[model samples]
Target: MTGNLHAGALLLAAAPIGRPEDASPRLREALSAAPVVAAEDTRRLRRLAGDLGVAVTGRIVSYYDQNEASRATELLAELLAGRDVLVITDAGMPGVSDPGYRLVREAVAHDVRVTVLPGPSAVTTALVVSGLPTDRFCFEGFPPRKAGERSRRFAALADEPRTMVFFEAPHRLAATLEALAEAFGADRPAAVCRELTKTYEEIRRAPLGALAEWAADGVRGEITLVVGGAPEPAGLSDPADLAAAVADRVAAGTPRKEAITAVAKENGVPKRVVYDAVVAAK
Candidate 1:
């Protein structure tokens, strides 16, 4: 019953993450009324429509990573024709590490009206349940498959102060945990949310090292990892403070030159500043 249907618009619909009962009435209406429904999986779309007992009168087309570009153009044309097109994914909202982004981007470029029928999102769901700080967080979809690439990915985020969310395959969860522990430090707190909103749901909250060890036994089902952000670096209010830190490292057997460099890097200040402080202390 949305006026945009006849006026031509792009509707991004959110599908239920697990249970069909969670589907909203607006989703049912959108599925039944849109001129065309672009789905990540056509079969899943049909199945979801069936579950909702809503007949999809419009055409259903697959819109996945492989065919997104070509299909997005096609959908944009439909939008230009003044026909509302609804975009949906297998689960959760479209465009969240899903195939709807290209279509949405094209729609915006073409001056097509874009709207969302928001519903379930695995990202927020896992974040709230993660027991980590949620005031600030970032989603790092999926890490690289290669060991070296994954290590680099974690290394880049090692100093990030926002909570981090990630999706990982069951088989690789343990290895990914190990890599995270190594990059972020073993005692960094994190949580593993498995099969969210589904039967056999499990949430394991602990330090990265403990989770790594637990996952070594192998894990199954969908996985969402939430890692606590890096603790804030101590403030260096005074040059004397910098000198004291460098001196501590030096007393721990690090050479004066190396300690100054390390302290400068850690404090994100200039080595010259730290060296000046060290000299002033002497």
Candidate 2:
């Protein structure tokens, strides 16, 4: 019976990341035009429609990450019946670090045509407003909340040449900037964009060290940090100097694991060899 149904179509609609007034006319029309609206949070979706003065004509259903797996088949069923299934996340584009990835994957598997409605994006908004170099950049999504894991992740990004953008909670902004300073260097240029595109929007551009100090006082609203990457180091290709760095950190009370990470990052060498050498010495 499912095989006999017409091909399904999935609509990925971008939601306002911060403000309701940013809703595009097309988004409002889609809200009223879709036969079914799959929302990350149906109540919030309804509220948004109310604020936009557009009544949703379709049935509203929850389709977030937790339920996406079990609900995909059902939503696909509705779509296959020639219903326009509009997928809206709580904010921003549906699949960008949001709940729509799984459903989109399922839709593709079912031979359903999928397209997006471009609208307000926190990533791009924060990047341009940040006053940092944006000629080459990459969206890092969000960093790990746990400090240890977050440190490790930042360490891995030490060699990234282009500018980087990341989403962070306001509460964690200080610690994240501190880690960026340690991994990238205190003198590296950076920008902290808070409450972007909202009435309280703020952008602070400074060295990572200074920004970390400023964020220590506490900031609110959604936060995005654009950080400069590790600069090309001088004499990084010297093996003996790299080995000496490993030895010095170990002498300074850094653990073998931590020391290896620090030295490999400083020398632009892979950590495996340094780790193997430390293990051999032990």
Candidate 3:
């Protein structure tokens, strides 16, 4: 049975990624108060509601990739009719590499109010604990499963400066990590966060090569990989060359110390490298 549509509002709530205790109060209220709830997996939704001690008072319907397009039309009509509909995924925010994008798009086209109750997200959770630079980062939902395609994808981002995050199935983790190491370099730092927020939650930080070796034995859980960005451009191998580059900065009245730091940062090298260059130039 449909509950109150609340002026045809569409609420996008994030379900707990793992631990149900992480579920926010707003999520509980939304689950119990919404007139209609569209879930990527209705069974999982029921389980989550149970864990949160929330009895979903609203009508729950299956909404997933396979049926998202058709479901959007039906859900949109309900929203337009002033029925409050809540859209949630199996985990994390809907429309983020998950279902709910279609409904949100339809809701906007029909001038329906759309809102979000942000909560647990594997992407952000993995990033923060990834030990990788969070200031500049990008999320690449899931890598292409095919070997050649996956290699090409990693090759395309070979020179990416921003830290990168990607989701991968457990069974393919080892092979994917090896490809990443090959394309991004073996020594590139990275983190493998698995089953985040779950009882067996594991976070392993190491060079891509090491991670590849570790996962070779096989893993079992949701996986998120955060890889450090590519190093600075090539051809500045000579310390003398780096020193010379900093010389120009120093000439511009940017103190030697500042010049060295700036040059190293711009070239994505260790500050010590630039500092040693300045010292060696003297």
Q: Which model scores highest in TM-score?
A: 1
RMSD of each: 3.2, 5.0, 8.5
Best by lDDT: 1
For candidate 3, write residues 1-282 as lDDT tens digits. Answer: 243345578999998898899999899999999999999999999999988899998888999999999999999888877889999999999998999888888777666788899998899999999988999999998999999999999999988999999999999999999999999889999999999999999999999999999999999989988999986676565888899988887788888888887787667677887788778889
> Residue 98 in model 1: shift from native, Å?
0.4
What lDDT score is found at residue 106 in candidate 3? 75
Q: What is the lDDT of candidate 1?
A: 0.91
Q: How close is candidate 2 to the true structure, as a TM-score?
A: 0.81
Report the C-alpha lDDT of model 2 over 1-282, residue by residue, as the tens digit: 243248657899999987899999999999999989999999999999999999999899998878988888898888778887999988889888777888778777777788899998888887888777788899898899999999999989978988899999889999999998988789989988887777988888999999999999998888888887666756445555556677888799988678888887666667886666556555
2 against 3, candidate with superior lDDT: 3
Clashes of 3: 3
Any idea what lDDT model 2 has? 0.85
Clash counts for the predictions, in order: 0, 0, 3
Stretch of 10 with least lDDT, candidate 2 = 1-10
